[model samples]
Target: MVNYALGNNVITQIGLLVHDIEKTSRAYADFFGVDKPQWFWTDEAEKAKTEHRGKPTEARAKLAFFNMGSLQLELIEPDRNPSTWRESLDSNGEGFHHIAFVIEGMKEKISLLEAGGMPLLQKGEYTGGRYAYMDTFKDLKLLIELLEKDR
Candidate 1:
């Protein structure tokens, strides 16, 4: 059995990068026969305390979520800022971005992943939790997002 670094192997969410979240989200809703979920912008830098590559950034993205059973599908349309989302969209074109896991010890998990060569790419705060994006693409073929919800 292989022990995972982020504590568990369960993926809670799958994120996709898109040029037009409005159009892409509508298409997904249509394809899935569900109503188009409402989209919202991420918190601004002041509120989110967003950082990219270890520096503070004002990066933000429009996001929409679709609950697909146990996993959520996230559509991200990033602004013209330096975020993991923007970087991936620009470098790789619009497509799959990351898979997220709900974690407990954010700092410890980040340290472990970074020590293992998967350095932290970006991180930010949300309403009830914080999230960090790890640069795991080279080995995992996709970025890994660690979501730590406040208790």
Candidate 2:
């Protein structure tokens, strides 16, 4: 499993990027035989960008959040815009985007990672907790989040 945490907990989440939102999410839902994930549109996440990246910009995203047992999965379908998701889709075809780890002390963790050479791609607070992104591999991405309970 992809490790997004630093000696934290077991792998708890997976993020997938797709060119077609409905098709991919439908496949996963059918495969898992689970209810559809809570959907979030670009407008809802507009404030998320500002909180993390500090800008009044929005990208069209069709996001679905689902659960497999205790593990959470996020499927992303990018809309036409200049966003990290869009950038990733442009560079690489639809596939695994990032592995997210639930952590504590986001700023401290981010500082250490940044000092160690990992760059912070974006961060935002939504739904309850704060999340940060970093490039752990040349191709794949890493996302770190402090859960609501952690904070």
Candidate 3:
């Protein structure tokens, strides 16, 4: 059954974690016939690493955004960091890592999920908007997110 917390009529993004950014992006672009994606580093994520985890190192993440009809596909490749994506790549090779769904009441959802089971792995907002990395990997091996889009 699909999780209703993700809401209806919308699933903003599907995040694909890859080991090779360029190759993966190109493959998706070719297969789906979509525009080239924009690559970016998660600046807010890096800062949080310093403050929260004390691992103040900059890890490269190449992001490519594309519109497949209506749903957005976000491809992410972590540059050799031993984070979740990296570990997944190292252990399982390049494949689907997470699916990020845009939602309202993110904070409340976080609490509700925590109360139920999924604990937060990481949570923060960037120039775009608020996002939370809640750990639901134990069951699904995927990171579940609640995103509040930034205007």
Task: Give the clashing pairs for model 3.
Answer: none
TM-score result, candidate 1 = 0.96
The regions of model 3 sitting more than 4 angstroms off are: 1-9, 44-60, 138-141
lDDT of 2 at 87: 74
Ranking by TM-score: 1, 2, 3
Best by TM-score: 1
lDDT of each: 0.93, 0.67, 0.68
Per-residue lDDT, model 2, residue 95, is: 82
lDDT of 1: 0.93
Better of 2 and 3 by lDDT: 3
RMSD of each: 1.5, 4.1, 3.6
lDDT of 1 by residue, 1-151 (tens): 2234677789999999999999999999999999999999999999999999999999999999999999999999999989999998999999899999999999999988887888999999999999999998878888999999999
Model 3 agreement with the true structure over 1-151: per-residue lDDT tens digits: 4353645436667878776777877887888777667577776444534111223334446677778766777777876654555666678877777777778787778777777677776565566677776788877677776788765
Clashes, model 3: 0
lDDT-best of 1 and 3: 1
